[model samples]
Target: MNAVATSSADVDAIAQVVAAVERAQQAKDAEGFLALFHPDALWTTAHGKVLIGLDAIAEFTRAVLPKDDWDGRVTYEVVHTQFLRPDVAAVKVRQVYHGPDGGSEGAPLYVMTKQDNGAWLLHANQNTPVQTD
Candidate 1:
């Protein structure tokens, strides 16, 4: 975690990527969501399923995302961000699903890397369900 000040431009760019994720999830567009990931990205689902690399991630996402039966609207908010380097950031996100039944939440950590082309892509991410006692 770097204590140095991060550029607002970079922060804004990261926020855009997160927003894209929200849009994709809400639309059930697996391809759109996968577009934000790095080629070698690692992802862990809220249920603890691990997906390594874009290929695996894509396979799992394509299989499940579109077919998801949860009739809920999902929202993603970037809660915090720590710059590991100028091109790497660890972002904490607050995820919530508003459904007919009720609302459920997730805490996701997305480690994103800035590409040479000036795009921030998800590198490693973990989605953990926020259980209520």
Candidate 2:
């Protein structure tokens, strides 16, 4: 998705995209989640496989997420929202997770965007491991 628009409506679109992503994750609806990405969107993780394009993202998710059976619950702390234009916005989100395997985790970044169709979608996402030194 090209993030080069400038308007209040664009900002709203981005927010909707963020909400959709969260909903998809909670529902374990990989299709719904992947549908939000562009045809050729790319994703990089802190570790494990790199997902490029919608198909790859779906495949990667199917391969890894099952190992955890995530509880489909997450809490988001939106640090800030930046509008590079209007359609292009990068929202810094911190997500807290409670894994089903009795393990707790958190994702520190979830970027949101507004696509060319004026619909918001998750263009890229990367969850960072918290450092506790």
Q: Pick the candidate with the highest TM-score.
A: 1
- Residue-level lDDT tens digits of model 1 in 1-133: 4386679999999999999999999999999999999999999999999999999999999999897587539999999999988999999999999987789999999999999999999999999999999
Worst 10 residues of 2 by lDDT: 102-111
lDDT, candidates in the order shown? 0.95, 0.66
TM-score of each: 0.95, 0.74
Query: lDDT by residue for model 2 over 25-50, one digit each (tens)?
Result: 77777777777777666777657457
lDDT of 2 at 69: 51
- Top-lDDT structure, candidate number: 1
Per-residue lDDT, model 1, residue 24, is 93
Pairs of residues at least 3 apart in sequence or in different chains that clash in candidate 1: none
Clashes of each: 0, 2
TM-score of 1: 0.95
Cα shift from native, residue 128, model 1 (Å): 0.3
